[model samples]
Target chain A: MTQFIQQLINGLSIGSVYALIALGYTMVYGIIKLINFAHGDIFMFGAYVGMVAITTFKLNFFAALIVAMAVTALFGVIIERVAYKPLRKSSKTAALITAIGVSFLIQNGTQLIMGANIYAFPQIIANQYFDVYGVRINLLQLVIFFTSIILMFILQFIVKKTKLGRAMRSVAVDKDASVLMGVNVDNTITITFAIGSALAAAAGIMVGLYYIKIYPFMGFAPGLKAFVAAVFGGIGIIPGAMIGGFAIGLIETLVAGYGSTLYKDAVVYGILILILIVKPSGLLGKNVKEKV
Target chain B: MKNLLNKKNLVSLVLLVIIFFVFDYLIKARILTPYYRTVLYWMGIYIILSLGLNIIIGITGQLSLGHAGFMSIGAYSAAVVLASNPTITGLFIGMGVGIVLTMIVSFIVAMPTLRLKGDYLAIATLGVGEIIRIVILNMTITNGASGISNIKMLMSWPLLFGFVVLTIFLTNNFKQSAIGRACIAIKEDEIAAEAMGINTTKYKVMAFMFGAVLASVAGSLFATTYYVVKPETFGVNTSINILIIVVFGGMGSLSGSIISTIFIGFVNMALQPYAEMRLISYALVLIIVMIFRPQGLMGAKEVALNVLPDFKSFFRKKEKSS
Candidate 1:
């Protein structure tokens, strides 16, 4: 039972990180209808950026987090403007292929620059633990959980209350109509990318902090699982992403704990295939019939 | 036989025969070098894989990313068979086993997975690929993670390219048939095809199973060539590499797939010294090409094979048309 609680906390920490990244995937997908395959790579890029901020720039943990977010946010905007924006009018497959290219570029380029070997994520946050009711919880887990909740709250507030959020929602619903309504559709899209990227950065940095090991390839597995989470929750639905992320995290941790970790990836992929078949609309998405 | 002897096809067939003989002679003479010969062999294998993938992704409009799973199925089955028999005849039997197993697996996979669309389909297939790799990783018969490397070594240039030819012939004929047209309609617009009574699911399953079996055939060749079968070799990267070839050449164009495979194969060979840049360049090429020309170099266009004697007239006609 103690082990169960311990695992649950760990799952929550990781789940929020997945949720953060899933938000980026969900938002970009919501607006552009492209999967933005580079998102996981972007998350990895953000982690590396945060690592640099602490190791090279000598920034505090919070400061590094902010720096990573800012840098990655700008990077995301540039990617949107250069890679995805031009292909917007073209086929979604083209856009998807380009997104994959960007993903490879970032993942491989990071390997080139950072080397393929895994490195100790600088202990910006010391590994300290606290126990409650015979269950141990770590400081980083608390940070990840609270920080994710706060960030999500802020995101919710922005989308619900802010004008940019309104523009984002409008763009998502009907881009042409939004344009007719005098919304700066391009600007909204860019900002949406920026916001999503920034959130990804936060997730990336927190992940680095929690795992204490950062590598170029670290993003691929979680990226995929988080994508499953997004799809599981109902793609393009923000809160659905959150729920899906937690569910995937819990399932993954439970499987690793009870079952052979060798089949961890297989189980996730199975769920992806199963959920996609059984509930294509996901736990939260509305079923939109295929149009003629 | 008469249809096979049509002017355009006769010219292409004669050209194929000449090229095969020339390469065969070069292999015998050791002129092309073993390294280049191996390159050509791999290229042929890649050609088969990409042609199959093109049938699924380009022609049939299903975004399948689990082809490597099928390829792995072929490769491991063949390797296991060869390990036991260790004869040319056994190798053939292994290939047969591969195709049968691939057919069964793909049929089961396609039945339910084909119902999804677009990105959902892509993710599901990717998941399926990962699952297959993981399953192989844990299986005892596959030697777990160490893989099955003790194959008897009975591979030949004729056998390899023969499969490539078969793949091309099948894909080409399939595309020329009513089934291929139905796939194209689905690619163009699935709902419209369904409205027209095209039995979208059945056609998709047919295309998927066919494409997967071709990959399985290529897989047998791949295992025989490498003399080793590891789960990692048939990972998502391999699947994506095949897709890259299909897209770079031109989706829905067999000739384009061939051209792109050769081009990318040679480029990879040239860039072997700079191993780091090979994938980086591929990524750049995909991004740049997608931005500039999403239809690819051929853009659903084929290289028209005029009779060899008409080379002069071909140029003259081009000049006149211009």
Candidate 2:
């Protein structure tokens, strides 16, 4: 029973990170129908940026978090402007290749800048154990999970309430129509990239704290997993991404606990395949019908 | 007859023969090191993988993130056979058997799954790829993560070079023929191709088979060259890397794929000094190209003589304009 409670906590914490990344993925896919393959690498970049903030700027955990998000958001905008914008009129195949190229560039470029060794996040958040009815929990786990939830809510509020949010929604639904409706489509896209990247940065910081290790290619697994979560939740749906992330988290944690740890990834991917086979549009995604 | 000699086709044919002799002489005279020979082995294998990838991505206009699964099937099959038999004849027999088995497996997997469109196909293929890797990981015959090693080395430069030439020649010929035109028509629009009396399914299956065959050849070469097989080595990353080479070269452009493969391979081998940065360089190439030249280095266009005439046109611009 205690083990179950412990597993739940672990699952929620990791799920929060996956949710944050998935949100970025879902949001970007919603706005621009391109599967931004480089989004994961952007998350990796955020981790590296956060590390730089801690070691170079000597900032506290919160400050580094802000800085990491800001830096990653800026990089996201730059990537959008450079990689995606120019190829707007090209075929999806072209865009797809470009996305791959961007993914490779960011990953390998980071590897060049930072050595292969995993960089440890500063222990500024402080590690403390809190007991809960005979079950002990780490303070950082709660911090990560709650912080992710809070950020998610804030994003929800922005997308659901704010004018810019409405504009973003409009742009995602129909770019041509949004353009006719006086929405700054390009700027909205840039903002989408910014917000998505910022979330990725936050996830990276939290992951760094939990694992105490950061590497150039670290984002590959988590990134791919987050993508699965996004797809599982029905890509382009925000709430779907959150639900999918948490579900993946719970499933992955349970698998690790019950099954061989090596099979965790296989199990997660297998679940995604099964889900996709059953519901092509995902759990929350609506099946869009074409006019033609 | 005189006009035929002046045709670009005849010129290319002659040039190909010359290049082949030069390559053959270099390997025969031992001018090229064994290291170069080994690199060529991977180069040939990569070409096979990339070409197979191109069939799905280029001709069928479907996205797959799991072509490496096909390679894994071939590699493991070949490795298992060679490991069981010590004779040289077994090696040839194993490769032939491996190639055939891989194609059959690919046919089964691709038949039902290729029905899924676009991103769905991508996801399914990815799943299929991961499944293959996991299966390999668990299989006792493959020896799990320790993999299969100390297999007989049955191939060298001369044979590998011949294989590469044959593959290129066959693929190029296919691309120029009516069947290749059918592939292009399919890429342009599947519905339209079907209306034009083309059997979209048949052509798609053919393209898939072609890709699978190349992957099988690559697998055989890898089994012979590396003499080891690991599940992790043939994962989604391998698929993505091959995709990168094909995309970087240009979709539907055989020459482009060959050139890009060599360039990327050269950079990977030569940039060992940079270690981790080599990966960074590759990533940068992917990102930059996607951003700037998403159509790849050639944009579905061949290199070689195809581009030379364009340069010639530039010089003869005034005459043609007049």
Candidate 3:
């Protein structure tokens, strides 16, 4: 029972990180209808940026987090403007291919610059453990959980209460109508990318701290799994992404705990297939028939 | 009958024969280094794989990211068969096994997932590919990451060249066939095709299975050439590489696929000196190509022999018939 609780706690921490990344996927997909395959690589970049801030710039943990998020947010906007905006009028397949190209570019570009070596992240947060009901919980896990929740709350408030959020929602629903309403569709879309990328940056730093190691290609697997989470919870749905992220993280952790670690990836992919088969719209996604 | 007996057909036939003989002589004379020969063999394999992928992604209009899974199945099945009996008959039997297995697997994968459209299908196929890789990584028969090594090297230059030719011939004929036309119709408009009484599901599955079969054949050849089959070799990277070839060549153009496969294959070999920048350059090429000319070089056109037009008009002064 204690072990179960321990695993659950670990799952929550990891799952929250996934939620942060999944939000980026869901939001960008909601607006642009492009998967933004480079989103994961953006998360990777965020970690590297945070690492550089702390190790090179000698910034403290909180300062580095803000720096990383700002840098990544700008990078995300650049990617959308340069790579995706021009292809918007092209075929969906073209946009998808370009997104994949961008993903490869970031991954390989980082590999070229960083030399594909794993870097040990500095311990910015002190690691301290506490026992509750004979179940051990760590301070870092608590920090991750609370920080993600706060960020999610802030995101929810922005979308629900802010004018920019209203514009984002309007654009997501009908780009043409939103344009008619003078929503500045392009600016809204760019802002969406920026917010999503900043959230992913936070996730990246949290993951780096939790795992204590960062690498160039580290984003691929986690990014893919987070995508699965976004789909699982219902793509383009904010709360759905949160739910899906946690569910996937828990499922992955439990599988690794009980089953063979080698099959963890297989199990996650299997669940993705199963979800796709059973609920193509995702768990939280509403079914909309295609119009002729 | 007239078309068959046309001067164009005869000339093309003679040209093909001469080219084959020249290649044979070069191989016999050892004028080509072993490294270059290996590159040629790999190019042939990639040509088959990319052409097959083209039938699915370009013609059939289904996005599949799990092609590497089918290729792995072929590689492993062929390697296991050849390991048991390293004979000419064994090679064919291995290829046969690979084709059958890929057919079954692709059927199962396509049936459930083909119902989804676009990005959903892409993600599902990606998941399927990852699942196949992870399963292979865990399975004992695959030797669990160490991979099947020391397998028989059964593919000769002539054999590979023949298969490449056969693959091109078959895909080209298929493209011009009724079924192929149906696939194109589906790609153009699935609903309109369905309204016209074309069985969209059946043709999509057919195109996918055909692509899978060809991929397996390529995989078998790859295993035999390298004398090893590793799960790692058939990953998302391999699938993407094949996709790049198809897109760069020009979707729905068999000639384009062949040309791009050879071109990219040689370029990859040439870039081996700067291994770190190879993938970066590959990504850049894809981006630049999509941005500049998404239609690709061929732009849905086929390269064929054309008769020379009469040049008498050039010399003659333009005089009205009246």
Candidate 4:
């Protein structure tokens, strides 16, 4: 029972990070209908940026976090403007391939710069453990959980209350109609990318701190799993992404705890296939019929 | 029979024979470097894989990212079979087994996932591909991650050349067949094709299976050439590389696939000097290509022999002269 609680805490901590990344994926997909395969790499970029800021520039943890988010947000905007905007009228397949191209570019480019080696992330925060009901919980995990929750709530408030959020929602619903109503569709899209990337940046820093390790290609697995999470809860729905992230994190932790670690990835992919087969719309996604 | 002996067919056959003899002579004379030979061999394998993938992605408009999974299945199946019976007959038997197994696997993957359109299907196929890799990694027969090594190397320059020709001929024929036309109809518009009584599901599955068959054959050749079959060899990167060849050549154009496969093969060789920057450059090229010319080099058109002028245009010229 104690082990279960401990595992649960670990899952929630990791799940919160997945949620941050999934929000980016869900938002980009919601607006552009492109998977933005490089979103994971953006998370990796954030980690690297945070690492550099702390180690090279001697910035504090929160400052580095803000710096990473800002830098990644800018990168997100640049990628969209340069790689995606031109192919807007092309086939979706072309866009997908381009997104994949961007992903490989970031991953390999980073690898070239970083020499494909894992770097130990410095401990920015003091590691302190707290015990509750005979179950140990770490201060870092608490910080991650609360920070993610606060960020998510702030995102929710923005989406629900802000004008830019309204524009974003309108653009997602109907791009042409929104443009007709003077929504500045392009700016809204750029903003969406920026916001999503910033959130992913936060996740990256948190993950780096939690794991105490960062690498160029570290984003691939977690990014893919976060994508699974987004699909699981309901892709394109903000709250759905949150739910899916935590669910997948928990499922993954429990499976690894009980089953062979070798098959954990297989199990996660199996669940993805099963969910896609059973509920194509996902858990929170509404069933949208093909119109044509 | 008469059509088989047509001038174009004879000329193409003679061209292929001459090319093969030249290549064999060059290798025998040691004029061509071993590096070039290896590159050509890899190019041949990629040509088969990409052509097969084109049938699914370009002609049928079904995007699959799991092609390497099918290829790995073929590679491992062939490797295991050839381990005991190391003969030409064993090679054929291995390829046969690969084809059948790939057909079955592709059919199974296609059935449920084909219902989902576009990106969903892509993700599902990707999932299935990863699942196959993981399963292979864990299986005892697959040697569990260390992979099957030191298989008899049966692939030769002549054999690889022959298979490449056969793959091209078969894929070209399949493209012009009635079933191929149905597949194209579905690609143009699935609903319209369905309305016209075309069995969309059946044709999609058939195209996918045919592609799997070709990939499997290529996989058999790959295992024999390298004398090793590892799970890591068939990953998302392999699948993407094949897709890159297909797209770079021009979707729906067999000739384009051939051209682009050779072109990229040479480009890869050239980029070997800058090993670390190769993939970065490759990704940049993909992005640039998509942005500048999404239709690719051939733009969905086939390269054919321009044997005769149009009779209508000739008559119009005559009328003007008169």
What TM-score does each of the candidates earn?
A: 0.95, 0.88, 0.95, 0.95
Of 2 and 3, which scores higher on DockQ?
A: 3
User: How displaced is residue A222 in candidate 4, in Å?
Assistant: 1.3
> Which residue pairs of candidate 4 clash?
none
lDDT of the candidates, in the order given: 0.86, 0.81, 0.87, 0.88
Candidate ranking under DockQ, highest first, comes to 1, 3, 4, 2
CAPRI docking class of candidate 4: medium
DockQ (Cα-based) for each candidate: 0.78, 0.43, 0.75, 0.73
- For B1-322, candidate 4 gives per-residue lDDT tens digits of 4354544555566667778899999999988888888898899999999999999998998989899999998999889999999888898999999899899989998988887787878878888889999999999988988999999988788899879887877787777778889988988899999999999999999999999889999999999989889999999889988988888888888778988999989989998888768888878988988899886777677655222322222101111111
Worst 10-residue lDDT window, candidate 4 chain B: B313-322
lDDT of 3 by residue, B277-321 (tens): 999988988888888788676756555411222321111112112
CA deviation > 4 Å runs, candidate 4: B305-322
After the best TM-score superposition of candidate 3, give how far the Cα of residue B32 lies from its true spot, in angstroms: 0.6
* 2 versus 4: better TM-score goes to: 4
lDDT of 1 by residue, A1-292 (tens): 8888778887788999999999999999999899988999899999999999999999998899899999999999999999999998998888888887898888788888889899887887777888798888888888888989999999999998999899999999999999999999999999999999999999999988888898987887888988999999999999999999899888888888888789877998899889989998899999897655
What is the model-wide C-alpha lDDT for candidate 1? 0.86
Off by over 4 Å in 3: B1-9, B305-322
Name the weakest run of 10 consecutive residues (lDDT summed) in model 3 chain B.
Answer: B311-320
With candidate 2 superimposed using the best TM-score fit, by how many Å does residue A181's alpha carbon deviate from the native?
1.8
Q: Which ten residues in a row have the lowest lDDT in candidate 2 chain A?
A: A283-292
Give me the displacement of residue A229 in model 1, in angstroms.
Answer: 0.8
